[model samples]
Target chain A: MAVVCFMVTMGLYFAATISFLAYLLRRSEALSKVSLGITAAGFVAHTVALVARMVGSSAAAPPSVHEALSFFSWMLILVFLAVEFRHRIHVLGSFIVPLALVSLISAAALPDTVPTLQPMFRTLWLHVTLSMLGTVGFAVAFVAGVMYLIQDRLLKSKRFNVLYSKLPALDFLDDLNQQSIILGFPLLTLGIITGAISAEFAKGAYVSWNPEQTWALVTWLFYFVVLLGRLTVGWRAKRAAYLTVIGFAGVILTLIGVVLKSYGTVS
Target chain B: MHVIVVGLSHKTAPVEIREKLAVPGSRMGEALTRLTSYSGVKEGVLLSTCNRVEVYSVVDDIEQGYGRIQEFLADTHLSLSSEQLTPHLYWHADDRAITHLFRVAASLDSMIVGESQILGQLKDAFESALSHKTTGLIMNKVVKKAISVAKRVRTETKIAEMAVSVSYAAVELAKKIFSDLGQRTVLLVGAGEMAKLAAQHLIAQGVGQVRITTRTPQHAVDLAEKFGGTAVPFEQYKDDMASADIVLVSTGASHYLISADDVQRAVTVRMNRPMFLIDISVPRNIDPAVRHVDNAFLFDIDDLKQRVEKNRAERLQEADKAEQLVVEEVGVLREWMKSLEVTPTIVALKQRADEIKRSELDKTLGRLAHLPAQDRELIEGLAASIVNKMIHGTMVTLKSEVNSSNGAAFVESARRFFSLEAAPPQDTRGESAVDSSSCLAHDMNAPLVEQVPSRTASRKQP
Candidate 1:
């Protein structure tokens, strides 16, 4: 039953991706509405699968690496849909949904392990979920940043195409990038602080610098400087958009390292 | 039974000749009356605009109708003779005339392919003819169908979506940058004519506020007052750029009026908000390097013109789609006209068959007059059913054959075979053939044959 539920979730995400692809090829009001509807359904199915997994786990333990990956994918979709609805950024779905599909597929292909519940893992789950949410926000900002550069290049070159006609203006994309960063930086800071506290409680040595923690701190500092530059020196538009794209890369690398380490510990 | 058009437009006639033939709005009633007064002319509409003057008439004979209309036009301008005007005029008969009118209404034949003015002008001409009572059943149907077809072409095709003028092009570019202009501000510098025109277009597009600045403060105030906007002093205009989403620069100064430093300062104040600067002046009021700023987009006169030309090309491509739609509609209208011509012959054949059935039934009943009442009722029912069965095949054949090429000749032969009296088809119908408004009404709703009137049998109102 769990396998069936997970397969359904993957299938829904794939269907939504196809709709978004059609909307990208030929811009139409009907097709855009359908894409949004399919994405919303896929998001609901993902939530159900994640909840089922958590309930079936031994002693209601926190999610393992595979389960957590699935949950992270779900969080990414939820944040993207929230921003899409609030800004009416219909074109952004064309870029965001395919990334969500990739994450879900990876989650489905990886093997799951039912690790014993550790006493300190509950506190660790809180920091892990918060970190996942922060990375989700940065992923959205990364997509917006890429769109900004493409639009900027198209306008600067004076080459008009179908995609150029459909994409939002550079200003809108840049603003969205900044807003996502502003939303993500604080969550990441809280996530890192809670992570250190949990590590101290579990191992009695929170000050030891692990590679993942070092990378997370570096990623957080990058965004912090970016936000500061934006506030103090008006460093936005192309410059800020590029930095957000780079910062998101740092966040993703750090997440992969953490997920792989957790998987190794389970094995 | 034929649609005829005879007139001169921008294509064939010089402005002097067209102006001479044009009937102004004040004289439209007189022109329409004269048009319908021509020999063999049944219904008429006069369309007179600055670019073209045309008379569309539903007439009996195309040859006589064209000659009469040409003479009428020459007489309107007494300085010219029919021969002198004939060289500049072009005439279309039947199917060609229908196609021409549809193309005109759809704006395919316009000087600018997708211009919207011609449609409105055509509508006004139709309403004028309608109000003058010079149009009857056929003209009414044709005009309404033309309007509906034009509307379809507009919605189904993108012929009118592109901007062809420089002022409109600026607004189009602005919309691409800003989705909603309702809360955006526009600042006009120099108060020049081009700037004023662009500002007006921006206002018409629903920009929030318009501020004008000029070398002479009074001129700025006067221009701003005309558009219901505020005027800023020339010295303070640089500072005002911080609040503006779009700036139209058209100063007469030879030097660059807005430098990169000025724009950088404005960006700092606005926290890098996007600003669109349009330089319509030949001397280039805004420095081109200002475009290098973070959120500044600058367009010069040449750039706007190029964009306009590109859009015009796209409109031409879209016009091809609109023309195809017009061709299809014309074919449908041609089929409808053919059905109108065959209606009279069909009605005559049915009437003749019914007369024979009634006479035969009377004779049979008289011969069986001594029969029982039940036997008499049985004979009447059987005879009526036989008559209906005989007429059904003939009615179906006639209706289907009306769409064929040799339909009129076929209809004529059928009339003669039934020993029916032959009359001119156009004169058979009241007012005009093709009172298709009734047919349209029937098709639009419940399919009740009771509402289908024998319009061809009625006489023309005296």
Candidate 2:
């Protein structure tokens, strides 16, 4: 039953991703609405499956890397759906749904060997949740940044085609990107701070110079520069969009590094 | 039917000619009634604007309607011969008339291409005819399609982007230069009609100051006071031009009023600041050579018209997409019209077949009065099956014929051949049951339950 539920959730997630991509390519509003509907259903199913697995294991926390990864992916999808519902930005799903599907598929393929919860694992869970929330924010910002660049280019070239016609205004896209960054950057800072505190709480002594921690700090600094540049230099729309794309790239690298380090240490 | 459009426009005739033929709004209804009642005319719609007064109509005889409409116009107001009116009057047959209406509604045929006001005017004329019931089926379809086409063009094209008139062009140029024109100053020279119009545009753009000048100081003061600007003498016009960022010159002189030297001095006095000068006069008031001076941007009438032409071209490109949508919608409406023609014939044919079954059953019942109830029921079911088999081929043929071009005539023929003119009593029970079920479905959270399973069961059992 657990495996069936997991497979169903993953299938719905992948189907939603494909539909969202179709909506972007074809620009069919009907397809976008359907994609959002599918994503909502998949989110509900995924939540049920996660709870079922936790209950089946009878564990206070996630027992394995697969479970932890699944939890993180589920959290990302939930955050994405919540934002989509609140903001009503159907285009963001074109980027986010695919990422969620990839995460789910990867989590499903990983070995499910349960790892004993060391005292530090609880601290690790907190770190994972915060970083995941921060990454979701970055993902949304990246979508807005891409739209802003495309819209700005079209407007500059004076070629107002249907694709450009369908997009939000240049000013709106720019503001959306800035607002996402503003909300995300502080959450990211708090996430990194809480992560350090967790590390200190678990190890009795601070662990320093880890590549994941170093890269995370670097990602934070990149966004901090972006926020500062926006505040001080009166950064133009295109420039801010480019910075967002660069900052998000740093974020992805940090996430990969963190995942790889955890896998290496666990094995 | 022959369609003739007569009257004058800004192209062939002046406003004085058009205004003489223009029917006032109060007299429009009486005009339409008179036009429809005229000899050889079947339907009529009159379009009267400041530029043109054209009567569009379908007539029984082409030359006769032409002569009647010409005589009617001659008798009403304009005492002109057919020879005089014939040159300006354009006569169109079937397809030309349709295309003319389409172009007029789309604003392509207007004096100003893509001007949206003409479309609204056309719609008002159409609705007036509709209210008076003067339009026939052909005009109804044509007017509705034209309105839809106009709407599609407006949405799909950028044709209505910038102002086309020279006065509006001057305003638009200022807007492009300064996104917010609330602080700009405008200087008007000569206080001519063109200059006054330019001042209106400047004030609309939120100009901070409007300064006017003329050879006659009283005229300049009167115009300045009207538009909330200060008046200055013609001798100080160059000085006022230095203070103004936008200057409109429309003087009545045959020679250049503002020489290149005058603008050159103003450019220096203004510290090489950019100035927009619009000269909307035939005997150009600003020197043609002044355009070469640094920071002095000059636009004559021809230059402004050229920009308007470019904007019109861009709008035409967008109209192509909109035209495709209109064509698609028209095709859909045509299909619905065809289907509507087939419906009544099919219903009547079914009723005829059912009536024959009921009469035969009544005759059989009289003969089988002595038979048992079970045997009588068996015989009745067998008779109904035979009747169904007999009409099945004809029903299939009717359904196939509906998809053809002559489908309406074919259905009419079928109804006559089958003696099925009278409609059968409608069964309200089944319809009421369906309506109630739909209401129940609406009240509930789920969709209307699919009847496929029950339908399949009935098919298999039968």
Report chain A TM-scores, every model.
0.91, 0.85
Clashing pairs in 1: none
Cα deviation of B94 in candidate 2 (Å)?
26
Superposed model 2: Cα runs more than 4 Å off:
A56-72, A112-121, A204-207, B1-112, B115-462
Worst 10-residue lDDT window for candidate 2 chain B reads: B434-443
Off by over 4 Å in 1: A114-119, B1-165, B305-462
List model 1 lDDT by residue over A14-60, tens digit each.
99899998888795879889989988988887888777877777744
Candidate 2: clashing pairs of residues: B159-B315
Q: lDDT tens digits, residues A59-148, model 2? A: 455346577667767876776677678767677687778878877887777766544223364555656566666776777778778876
| Per-candidate local distance difference test | 0.74, 0.65
Minimal lDDT window, size 10, model 2 chain A: A114-123
> CA lDDT of B173 in candidate 1?
75
Which CAPRI tier for candidate 2? Answer: incorrect
Each candidate's DockQ score against the native complex? 0.24, 0.01
